[model samples]
Target: MPLDLPSDSDTATLAETFRLLGDPTRLRILFFCLEAPRSVGDIAESLQLSQSLVSHHLRLLRGARLVRGNRLAKQIFYELSDKHVSGMLADMAHHVREDD
Candidate 1:
């Protein structure tokens, strides 16, 4: 059967998403938030990145809908936007580990 392709706008959006995921720092941040919601401080400390840097990356990730944040009091905790994001990440990780 022939596959249906995305519209040009959707293709551009998907490309943009891939470009956002291409950054090493952003990718690390996404992986860090894979398991559970994490505050900027928690992620920064665990990843050994400055809080400001983490915040910057989070903003971009949030813009791309790759991650979402929930405000709890004065702190906001971030996690993967949905299972689709996690599933894609997991699939890619598995793909990388496969024997060539």
Candidate 2:
């Protein structure tokens, strides 16, 4: 369930969003998904994870509404749920950069 917050709750949402991204496995999944909608098998292969393990992580991501899936034939392809994830990642990278 979504937390009930006052009118100004952008930070709450952002915090929750980042919390979901805190896991390294989840971070890799998000980056891979950002590249293209991919099948569980593809993610497993690329990340060197078993299909079952990848599926488990995907389930968590789906539960958080951070990823979306599309079925093609007997396979399901996954992608980011919205542009917010991409935008947040980009903004984070920009702000977290070190001085030259």
Candidate 3:
């Protein structure tokens, strides 16, 4: 089956998204949020990263629509934006583990 390509601007946006996912820190953060929403402090502590660093990365991820945050009291918990993002992460993980 043939795949239809997106327009140039859309392609650029897609490429930027890939670029964002290419970062190890951002990728780790995404995986951390894969199962459930997590607070910045929790993600930082679990990932051994500074809360500020996690917050910075989260801002970028949120900007790209790769993740979404929901405010609960004074804390904002983040998770994968939708099933599509989760599916992509899962599919990529499977792909990397596949034998040649």
Q: What is the TM-score of each candidate against the true structure?
A: 0.89, 0.77, 0.90
Give the poorly placed runs of model 1, Cα more than 4 Å off. none
Segments of candidate 3 deviating more than 4 angstroms: 1-4
For each candidate, the alpha-carbon lDDT, in order, equals 0.89, 0.86, 0.92
Between candidates 2 and 3, name the one with more favorable lDDT. Answer: 3
Judged by whole-model lDDT over C-alpha atoms, candidate 3 comes out at 0.92
Q: CA lDDT of 22 in candidate 3?
A: 92
Q: What is the lDDT of residue 29 in candidate 3?
A: 96
**TM-score for predicted model 2 compared with the true structure:** 0.77
Please tell me which predicted candidate would have the highest lDDT against the true structure: 3
Predicted structure with the largest TM-score when compared to the true one: 3
lDDT of 2 by residue, 1-100 (tens): 8878655477776677778799888888888888799999999999988899899989988987899999999999999986878877767666779565
Clashes of each: 0, 0, 0
- Between prediction 1 and prediction 2, the one with superior TM-score is 1
State the number of backbone clashes in model 3.
Answer: 0
Between which residue pairs do clashes occur in model 3? none
